[model samples]
Target: MLRTIFLSLCLSLPVLLPAASFAQQKSWSGTAEPRNEKEWIRAVQLRVNANAVNSFMTNRLAGTGRAKGVAALTVEIASDGQIKAVSIRTSSGSEEVDESLRRGVMALPQMPRFTPDMQGDSIALVIPFALHG
Candidate 1:
């Protein structure tokens, strides 16, 4: 059987900042740490695409009964672009799916290095993945 899966990306910042501040900034160039929520979202979207989590989940879930739910994950990325850790803030109602999502994120390669402007050795982001079939 052929299964269809749709992946949606939603990012939640650790600290809520004024939208006006982000709106006034120039677009992120993908070279340094993201300066605002929008830029950070863009960076995360790029990393998700590079990691191919959608495809990974599709393949991983093939022949399985579980396919639809939302999983919220907390990811910590080091200044050097390495993924320091990944934890599930909310599960997708299935251990299989949750584990698969975690594995998919953990497979991500090095991301953009954080700039001094960011002021942190590592950053934690709450990313929600919506999976639908």
Candidate 2:
């Protein structure tokens, strides 16, 4: 009986796995957007952090020493997940660092799409970044 159950479970995994994967994809692909503004902001932050890490790993970012600073940027993201615009809300005390951050955000190919429940054509986010040398 145990062997039969194990065999049945194994056979069912392939069918179950695809359904799970599709549901996950649908959730992030804009079918099920974040439930609120806070959740949306968190999602955006996560994506930015991930991109920054990837860029740093690839040596695409400026030298660590030069990039070190704290900065805040007001970014406008379209409902479709495009970065519409980026403006520095608080400077990093270095024009180079500020511009670098702005350019990096603008260069992104895409961002998380606005949650379907979110009310607006676009959302503005004040994202803070602190780089350590």
Candidate 3:
């Protein structure tokens, strides 16, 4: 009986792991869906520190005396509030500024928890960053 129980557990481990992973993924994606608009906005707001972002970009792209443009960022955050990807959908014209913006998003300090399962396996959101240098 013990041997049989051990075998059953071993067989179920793989299934259980994937189910958990899938659940996590679903949660992340669900956050941005129409049903969870409030949670989505809160997640986006807490993910990045605007002050830190402004400071980093200003310092990194001080060239030309100033940098002015808008970067459209699509960020993917996991259920546990981990940033998986930060993609720049639209550029600010200046390569330096664009790169800095991406870096800042990637280096976001923490993903604030406004609600449980706010950050699923992945959430895709477009956020605009206005750069005025």
Candidate 4:
């Protein structure tokens, strides 16, 4: 009976072992160091210009006749090349302009990787969109 019990216990061990092994695995691979601000800016620029910068060219809020302003956005790009979240870190002070900026950033494709800086391989991206000069 003892031998039979031991075999049963051994049979269950493999299933239990995998759960423990998986739990010990790390969530992210490849270190995320500080990324170059310039590089991030360039990425944003490329994204904006991919289809021409015309998408954000004008805003007619309440028929005000095309206001001019710049919108700034800060986004955190995960190591997986996904835009984790975006916030209007700075804005052109117009709701229309700000919303447009947010929309443009949201429309960007998922980035896969970024270069590292002193901060250890993490990247913070900022995108600025200008409308009406």
Candidate 5:
């Protein structure tokens, strides 16, 4: 009985293994070009977007004794055109205003495109968010 049970367990162990282990993994080894015009374009666009949102937020707080300096916000937008994550990369010595701005941008509409930063089929991009008074 012990040997039968052991043999049965051994036979079923293979079946119990995860399907992922046997499945082929998709390759993400695409080429990337970090330094190029596309990167500059992406950076400019991100800066523009960030500044626009910040300006709108500042306008809303007008006449409320708001003092503005500068802040660097970091936002990650996924390929699906959604703000996946947002955080204040550098605060202008004011957490309250930084948090407000971050929330404001997060609430904005999704960016229209995920334009690839590329050179000869390789692609890379760094989108930055900058706000200034």
Candidate 6:
């Protein structure tokens, strides 16, 4: 009976290990939670979309872009939501495309700001820009 039980457990171990690792990975991923102050991330996204239209970046992209790949940036924001610094973590391969994205980021106006209780000294964001025809 002891050997039979041990064999059954060993067979199940392989199946359980992948599931355990997946759950662990999902938890560690820095996804946003709908906490009060943290909501600024959403606001920033919306503002970026709106601000993109008719801006200097419009000329840089040349035409309607269909989102080829994603780029990344590390942005430092003060407790007041003012951007302290902007650093590009990953490039979109083309210098023109990367510079266009940079211009768009620099054009963003001061946000509505965050309260003192907000966590984190800064946040890293992934920006996906489309590829033009």
Whole-model lDDT values for every prediction:
0.57, 0.56, 0.49, 0.44, 0.40, 0.43
**lDDT tens string, model 6, 1-133?**
0000011110110111222222222121233433464455555554444443323235545444522354554445554556566556566565665565566556565654554555555544444333332
Name the lDDT value of residue 89 in candidate 4.
67
Model 6 TM-score on a 0 to 1 scale: 0.55
* Candidate 3 C-alpha lDDT tens digits along 1-133: 0000001110110111212222223234433432353644544543343422543435555435446766666666655456678777788787776677677667664353335534334556666655555
lDDT of 5 by residue, 58-130 (tens): 5554334442555555555554335566676656566665666666556555433335542232222222333
Candidate 1 lDDT, tens digit per residue, 16-132? Answer: 233322222233342576766456546665565434344444556633557566678777777676778878888879877767667767776565666545556677776776655
Candidate 4 CA-lDDT value: 0.44
Model 3: clashing residue pairs? Answer: 28-120, 66-133, 79-119, 79-120
What is the alpha-carbon lDDT of model 1 when measured against the actual structure? 0.57
Residue pairs with colliding backbones in model 4 are 32-120, 32-121, 32-122, 33-120, 33-121, 33-122, 34-120, 34-121, 81-111
Each model's TM-score, in the order given?
0.64, 0.61, 0.57, 0.51, 0.46, 0.55
As for candidate 1, its clashing pairs are: none
The lDDT-based order of candidates, best leading, equals: 1, 2, 3, 4, 6, 5
Best by TM-score: 1
Distance from true position, residue 104, model 4, in Å? 1.9
Q: Give candidate 4 misplaced runs (Cα > 4 Å).
A: 1-41, 49-54, 57-64, 115-122
Q: Give candidate 2 misplaced runs (Cα > 4 Å).
A: 1-36, 56-64
Off by over 4 Å in 6: 1-35, 52-57, 64-67, 130-133
lDDT of 4 by residue, 23-132 (tens): 22232223232267455444434443432233343332323544355555666666555666667866667776567556645655565354453233344555554444
Q: What tens-digit string does per-residue lDDT give for candidate 2 at 37-82?
A: 6666666665555444444434534455655666677778787778
Judging by TM-score, tell me the better candidate of 1 and 3. Answer: 1
Clash counts for the predictions, in order: 0, 0, 4, 9, 0, 1
